[model samples]
Target chain A: MMDKEKIKFTDEELVARFQQGDERAYIELVKRYKDRLLNFVYRYLNSFEQSEDVVQDTLMKLYTSAHMYREIAKFSTWIFTIAANLAKSELRRLKRRRVVSIHTMGYDDSEYEIPSEDFDPEKETTSNYGEKQIQEAIDTLPDQFKTVIILREVQQLSYEEISQILGISIGTVKSRINRGRLRLQKLLKDLKVR
Target chain B: MDCYSFDKVISDYIESNLSAKQKQEANEHLAQCPACSEKLADMSQLLGALRTLPRPVTRPDFESRLMARIERQKQQKESPFIHVFHEYSRVISVAAAVLLFVATSLFVYTSVVLPGSPASVPSASIRSVEPAAALPAAAAGVRPEQAGGVAEKTLPDTNRVQNPDYNSRIMMVNE
Candidate 1:
């Protein structure tokens, strides 16, 4: 009965409880956000394992820094900001690692294995291929457009929420979402042609 | 509206964010323009696909792992050393302050007070030393006899020699 009651509490209410040292409230908050954060982070990183790590780190930060949260900002916006910042850091770290690996490779070193994208008759269908194509198109977008597109289109967050998470104006969020969609349309069209 | 202008307002039009007049203009333009209409269709299709994309779930043990990490973090926060420090912090601070006060008082006594104590130097020696010390006063314009008498009358009886040999050495070194 208590668990069911906690499940009904809003994210902000849960955070407020957690601030007052309610351990169960923290657990409930984690349950509510973990998968959502994983999905958001995975879209940004395109790597499930790293996304999970980023989400864990984000929750850990929330655990340690719960006192820093102010009631003025929406709880979702604050949590998503932490997830997005960590995802961006992870992306940068991956890029740096790739650069280092490239620099260190020698002619005698074995060739890096590229994952095959061969069609699987049993496992993959038309919808799967379309989804893959759309994801690839999204991946090709610039960071700003990709983030806005994922937040607006994929996550289905309000413009106000995206603006708060990204620390931008609502006008900027709308413009970015529009431009991101336009760019995504072009990328998908290009993909279909290929 | 031409294709370029229609492109500019397409998103606003789709989102119903345009004013009625602008929206009406966009509608009339869309009716005649195949290219602009196709662009809108493509954008709609892309947004639909994005919305329906499969959301990935975390691994099965995600909760357990997070709880374990949180437990470890709690343990670290409540570690014995930190716990002890927090418990005794006020007492430690007060002790430190008292020690500092005592050390400062001792330093002041040894450096400023002890050297001036009468037992460190007899009062008779101070009176005898004052006459020799008055040579500098004499040089500064007072007559030697007047400087000696002034030094004798003005020098405090409680004055002690800082360096035991400071006055006698000066007297012997000069004489």
Candidate 2:
């Protein structure tokens, strides 16, 4: 019998409990972070399936490397750093496995296509294309701007935390967010004009 | 404040990052300039929309699925010591092969390649100093002093000097 109230602890407290071998604390941490991380990674990688995989790897790292977690940084920052690195590595791998353009071959081929099984065609069709347009606009952003936007807007993390996770200065984080939002604004305006 | 300065810090102003003086300057510029004001409105709206974008949902069983995967991972993991060994297993195997090769080469050189006889040793020079007169009739002919001459005559090549007398002396000593 576990107390539901214990789940209300801050992430740092829960991580401390987890380091002390409290499995329930680990579950609580997962419950608190999984959705936010999934969204952040999905926006970064643009594939729901790979985002889920990256999140899973990040959590597993937390579990196995609990002893390595220090109290100096926010747990969210540390976890996001892991997830960001994993996402970047996955992106690099996808780059290496370049998908041959459909124009290259006479016939449509799915074998060399990277499988994104979690993509929901039905949902894409239902939203009157607002969500899809926004997603596409976001997709057009360079990796740095895309990451800054996702972390700032989606995760709602503070500039300091983002700077720590990105290993950049706070000034850099702020400027990047400003530039990203400006780019997003321009993209959205263009989309609306059409 | 002119439009140029206000435009540069509009984002900071919108996000409340501007100081009081900078904020006042931006406000004065926005009051008179319709273009700057409209731009500010659009930028704020854009920021609002971005903030309001729906958060993507995780599957309902996300936690259970993750926990199951974690359990599998834990079970599959090797023990710490074994894991360390497994990580360096390639290097360890390569080093072992190199060491075995060196030891084998040394053994072959000492036992089969360098010595003329199995009984010949590091102290072969001491044995060679023994008088041929003290030798048995069979081994007397195989004097150490004549060894170089017999070897040179029979086989000039360095590797082919298998002295028959040395082998016979070794066999006799063994018997």
Q: Clash number for every model?
A: 0, 0
State TM-scores per candidate.
0.68, 0.65
In terms of lDDT, which candidate is strongest?
1
Query: In model 1, where do residues sit more than 4 Å from their true spots?
Result: A103-129, B80-175
The lDDT for every candidate, in the order shown, is 0.79, 0.74
Question: Model 2, range B1-175, lDDT digits (tens) per residue?
Answer: 8877776687799889899988888888889999889878887766665566555667677778888988766655746666667779999999999999999988877776665554344344234332343344326576433443222223233323445365445434433
Instruction: For candidate 1, give the lDDT of residue A32.
Output: 90
| Top of the candidates by TM-score | 1
Error of 1 at A183 (Å): 0.9
Q: A90-193 in candidate 1: lDDT tens per residue?
A: 98998898788888988797534322134121232223237777778878999999999888887989999999999999999998988888888888778888
Reference contact recovery of candidate 2 = 0.30
Q: Which stretches of model 2 miss by more than 4 angstroms?
A: A98-129, B78-175
- Model 2 chain A weakest lDDT span, ten residues long: A120-129
In model 2, the Cα lDDT at residue A101 comes to 45
Clashing residue pairs, backbone N/CA/C < 3 A, model 2: none
